[model samples]
Target: MVQNWSVFVSVSSFLLLLLLSKFILRKTRQHKSLPPSPPSYPIIGHLHLIKEPVHRVLQQLSYKYGPIFALQFGSCPILVISSPTAVEECFTKYDIIFANRPHLLFFKHINYNSTTIGSAPYGPHWRNLRGFTTLEIFSPTKLNTFLSIRQEEIRSLVKNLYSYSQQSFAKVEMKSRLSELSFNIIMRMVAGKGYFGAEVEDYEESRVFRRVIGEVFALGGASNPGDFLPPLQ
Candidate 1:
C-alpha cells in the first residue's frame, strides 16, 4: 500500500513539473516581437471586437492599426494583412512557415485525426494526400467522365426554374435551387447518387450523409469553447 502511494505521488509530481515547464517555455517564446495589435481582454482576447460584415471590420482594423496587424481571436493569434504587397510576400517568401494548421479538435474528430488534406499539417503525408486527390479525384479525365452528371444537374435546375417561370413573372429563388443542383451533381459524381433533396438513390446512405454534412456545417459555423479553453477539452 505504501509503495503504491509513493508511485502515485511520483507520477503526479512529474506531470506537474512537465506542465510548469511547458508554460514557462511558452512565455519565453512569446518575447519574440509580433505585429501591432489592439488592446485585448484576458482569456477571450479580441474576439469581442468582431462585428457584422467581417471584411468591413477587418478594413476598419487595418485603418486603425495599419495594413498589417495582429489579432487574437480567442486563443488563436491571427496576422491580418490588407496590403497586397505584404500578402504576396507572405505567400511567396514565407509560405512554408504558414503552411501548418492549428491542431484543432474539429480537425481531429471530423477529419479522421487530421489525416484529411485540408486539415493535415504540411508534410509528406499531406503531399501524398494532395497528389492522390489531384490525380485520382480531381484529374481532368475523372471529371470528364462525370460530364453527363453535370449536364443532368444543370437540366434539372433549368427545368425547376422554368416551372416557376411558367406563371406570370413569378419570383424564382435560384440560390437554393443552384446549391441543391451543385450538391446533387457532386454527390452523383462521387458516389453515383445524391445525398440531399430529390433523386437520392440510396435512402439510408443519403440520410446518413445528409446528417453528417449538416453536422459538419453546424460545427464549422459555431465556435467551440474547448478550442479556446484547453481545460474544457
Candidate 2:
C-alpha cells in the first residue's frame, strides 16, 4: 500500500508540473507573436515530435507549417527556415540579427567562457576576431608562409602510406590519418611544433594535445539537455 501511494503521489506531482507549465506557456504566448508552430506539449514542447532522420522530420514539418516555422524545445524557441529565398535573405540582409550562436554548456566550459572566435557572441569582439582571422591568420600571405609545413606533412603521409603498403596491400584508416595531418599542420603553424605525425618530439605533450582535441570535437556538436531545460541548468 505504501509503494502504491508513493507512485500515486509521483504521478500527481508530474501532472501538476505539466499543468503549471502549460499555463505558463499559454500566458507567454498571449504576449509574444511567435511564428507558426505545430502543437507542442508544455515542458517538453516539440521535443517529443522530433524523430530520427531529423532532416526528413523537419521537411515534413515544413510541409505542414510552411517554409518558416517555430518549434519549442523545452524552454528554448527555435526558428526553422526551409526556403532558399528566406535563407539567402537571412544571411544577406539580417545576418547581424542572427549572427550569434546559441549559448551551450560545452561552449561555456571548453571555450574559455565563450570568448574564442568560434563561440564569441556577435558584437565588437566578434568583429575584431573576424578581422584578425581575415588579415592575420587566413590571409593569402599567411597561408603561403605555411605552404612548406603543409607540403612536408602531405609528403610524410604519402611516405607512411607507401611504407605500410610496400610489402603487401594494406588497408589504412584514412579518417585518422587525415585527422592527424590536419592537426599536425595546425599545431606546427600555431605552436611551431607538430604534436601529431612522426615529427612529434614530446610524446606526453602529443598525448595531452590529442586528448584535448578529441574532447573538444566530441563536445562541440553535442546537445546538452541542460541547455534547453532551465530546471536542469
Candidate 3:
C-alpha cells in the first residue's frame, strides 16, 4: 500500500512538472513570436474593444502598439497592418498564405457561396475565376463597349441635378444621388438595364434589387456578434 502511494505521488509530481514546463514554454513562445496585442479577457477576448468605423479603431491601435499588431477577436487571432510598407510586404512577399478571404457569412451566404473573386478561396477554382475576369469581364474592349452606358448614366445624373436646381436655390443631397448613379451604371453593365431613375427595364426586378442592395449595405455596415463567437452562429 505504501509502495503504491509512493508511486502515485511520483507520477503526480511528474505530471505537475510537465504541465508547468508546457505553460512556461507556451508563454515564452507567445512573447517571442506573436506581435504585440492589446489587453484581452477570458473567452470574449478583445471583442469588447471593437466598434463602428473599425478602420479608425485599427488606426488608433496601430499608433498605440505598432504598425503591425495582433488582436484576439474571441478565439480568432487577427494581424492588423497599418503601414503601407508592411502591407506591401504582406501582399508581395507572403501573399499565398494570406490570399484567401475569411469564409465569413457575408462572403459565403450573402455572396452566393463565395464564388465571386473577392470572396473565393485561393486555389485552382479561384484562378479560373480570376482568369475569366482578366480575360473577359474587365478587359479593355469590354469596358469600351460599356462606354455608352456610363455616359448615359452621367448625363441622366447631370440632367436630374439641373432639374432639381433649375428654379432657385435648392438643397440637394448628392450622396444618395451619386450612390444610385453608381448602381445604375453597374446594373446597366451587368444586366443590360438601369434599375434606378427613368425607364427602368423591369419595375418588379428593380424593386427587388433595390431591397437586396439596401439589405446588403445595411448588413455590411452592421456588426455581427456571431463573427467573434463562432458557437453563437
Candidate 4:
C-alpha cells in the first residue's frame, strides 16, 4: 500500500512540474511573438476600453497604434487592421492567414454552429454553395424577371405616401414607411406573394411582417464582443 502511494505521488509531482514548465514556456513565446498592445486589467483584459459603438473606439485606437495592431480581450488575442493599404495587404498577401473568421456566440446560435455559407470554412462545400447561389438566386436573368414587380411595388409606395401627405395635419415617419415598402417588395418577389393580398391595401399582417424584418435587420447590423473575442464566443 505504501509503495503504491509513493508511486502515485511521484507521478503526480512529475505531471505538475511538466504542466508548470509548459505554462512558463508558452508565456515566454507569446510575449516574444505577439505585437504590442495596450495594458490590460486582470480577467477582463482590454474590454474596459471598448465603449458604446465599438467601431468608433477601434477607429480611434487605430490612429494611436499602427494600422495593424493587436489587442487582448479577455485572454483572447485580437488583430485589428484599419488602413486601406493594410486591408489590401491582408487580402492580397496574407489571405489564407486572415480568411478564418472568429467564431462568435450569436453566429453559432443563428447559423447552426457555422454550417451556413457565410460562416462555413474555406473548403469544397463552401465553394459549391457559392456556385449554386450565384447560378440560381443571384443570376442576372433571375433579377431581370423581377423588374416589373419592383416597379409596381415602388409605384404603390409612392401612391400611399401621396395619400398620406394629402390628409389633414399629415405627419409621416419616412423611415418606417420605407422599411415596410422594402420588406413587402422583397417578400412578394421571393415568396411569390406579398404579406398582404394584392387587392388589400395597408393590411395589419403586412405591417407586422415589415416591423419584424426591420427588427431583424437592426440586430444583424450591430457588432458583438464574441466576434472579436473567439474564446468567449
TM-score for candidate 4: 0.69
Give the lowest summed-lDDT range of ten residues in model 2. Answer: 23-32
Please report, in order, the local distance difference test score of every candidate based on alpha carbons: 0.82, 0.88, 0.83, 0.73
Tens digits of lDDT, candidate 3, 75-177:
4678888889989988899999889887677776787889888888999989999999887868999989889988999999999989988999889999998
TM-scores for the candidates: 0.80, 0.83, 0.80, 0.69
Candidate 3, RMSD to the unseen true structure: 7.2
The deviation in Å at residue 156 for candidate 3 is 1.0
Ranking by lDDT: 2, 3, 1, 4
Better candidate by lDDT, 1 or 2 = 2
Off by over 4 Å in 2: 1-32, 167-170
Give candidate 2's error at residue 217 in angstroms.
Answer: 1.6
Q: How are the candidates ranked when ordered by TM-score, highest leading?
A: 2, 3, 1, 4
- Model 2 whole-model lDDT (C-alpha atoms): 0.88
- Candidate 2 residue pairs that clash: none
What candidate 1 gets wrong by more than 4 Å, as runs, is 1-32, 51-54, 202-208
Instruction: Evaluate model 1: give its TM-score.
Output: 0.80
